[model samples]
Target: METSSRFEAAIKKLYTAFHNNTLNPECCKQCAVGNILDNTDSWKYLSDDHGNLSLNYVGKVHQTLGRKFNGYSPLELLQIEATFLKACGFQIPLNHTNKRPENPTDNDILFNGLSATISLLCEIDNIPNVMDYQKLFKYKKTTFDYIVH
Candidate 1:
């Protein structure tokens, strides 16, 4: 079991879980990178010497999804993740305690920001069917490959 294979298996498991409606976003947020690292056995792989498993795994997922994942960095991936969540109707947490802004364009800005992130990730990770994220959020696809890798 190598790092790449492990990464593929983990992502596949995620894909299956997502399709089965059993993945808990809350749990994913809690463990984040650590969860992937710990689950390598289920997937069968290990991190490289540089602790670059997350980036490498994302790249592999991108390739497996038929998109290029080398163009962006983790920060960029974070941005995309934020946007994707927004497009899926998830609200962005506001730092200000004041009431939410009443502007309609606020949602548009949020969506564009997310879309840009997704597009960038798709380019870097070589993910296929960039539109699939939108579809997945909309529950249109039974299974979708949107991993940042």
Candidate 2:
């Protein structure tokens, strides 16, 4: 799959923000994941009105799709990001029993969630949507995958 320069720049900006101490690592993770989910139909079940991931979506994804949480079960998506924060050596508020104390363990394990999200977006025939997850997120838009403009 190709990559999008805009999306790559955005994620790079986020990384810079985290390094500059403007945006914390947890928020960086959420924004990264949220932006990904937002650009897809999974936004319906994964985000709230403000486009942030909600506990409701968390419960739904877990219950409906069996997408297991790496850290906390009964928690907000932000909490999951926070878990990643803790694993990354940041202090979390009201910490719980972390499933993986060393989180972002595999470069955010993004494929795990994105794979499931893609499954939900596809039809029973396993055909991918117009907004191919990787291509879209990577900002690699072609006429075949999606409209250029």
Candidate 3:
């Protein structure tokens, strides 16, 4: 399956961040969209709150102007963050009172978050989920000749 260059770049960056232990939901510069944007916190301006899907005034302006950061609109960035946070067991619009995983950096939690984010990215690009490894299990049947020992 073919994927857009932008998607490929974003996924590569995300994969690196995940393995490097730099992906953090609580930090703007290390979050899902942040990593996609090369670990820049500038995407935070796209939304008023972390994990918020609604874009603020600045985000609206960018979206209206047809601006894309790392090939994603401001709205898409916000949605990606929201999806990551949700998959990581974080309550939307992250706050002190919201429920969240005890260890946000846990491998399992981060993996789930990354998986969901990748799915969303694929959805946005109308491509198959890259993380789906089920294809590797497909096997071809072949007739085998055997001799009893």
Candidate 4:
């Protein structure tokens, strides 16, 4: 299936970060959007609080200006981060007392987070989720002929 260059780039970045032990739900520079943006924290300025789906003033300005970072808008980046954090077992908006995984860096936790983030990315682009394997299990009908003696 063909995907946009942005989608491909984001997947590659997330894959590298996941395997490199750089993906962290609590860190701005290592979060899903951060990795997608090449480990830059600039995207954090797009929102006032981490794990927030709403864009702040700066983010609003960027969105209004049609500015896209790494092929994602500020709002999209925030949504992606929120999705990752939530899937990783953290409460939205990131409070210290909120429910979160005991080990945020655990591979399983991070994998779940990455999976959700990737799903959201695909949704944003109106493409099929890359991690979805259901299609592979679908049965297809084929015609066959049998001759009886």
Off by over 4 Å in 1: 1-13, 30-73, 94-121, 127-149
**Candidate 4: TM-score?**
0.91
TM-score of 2: 0.26
Q: State every prediction's TM-score relative to the real structure.
A: 0.32, 0.26, 0.89, 0.91
lDDT of 1 by residue, 114-133 (tens): 34443544454555535355
lDDT of 2 at 125: 24
Question: What ordering of candidates by TM-score runs from best to worst?
Answer: 4, 3, 1, 2
Residue pairs that clash (backbone atoms under 3 angstroms), model 3: none
Q: Cα lDDT of all candidates, in order? A: 0.38, 0.38, 0.92, 0.92
TM-score of 3: 0.89
Select the stronger candidate by TM-score from 1 and 3.
3
Candidate 4: where is the Cα deviation over 4 Å?
Answer: 140-149
Write model 3 residue lDDT over 1-149, tens digit each, in one string: 89999999989998999999999989999989889998889988888888888888999999999999989999888989999999999999998989999999999999999999999999999998877899889999999999899
Q: Which stretches of candidate 3 lie over 4 Å from their true place?
A: 136-149
How does residue 20 of candidate 2 score in lDDT? 46
lDDT (tens digit, per residue) of candidate 4 on 1-149:
88999999999999999999998889999999889999989999988899988888999999999999999988889889999999999998998777888999999999999999999999999998988989889998999999999
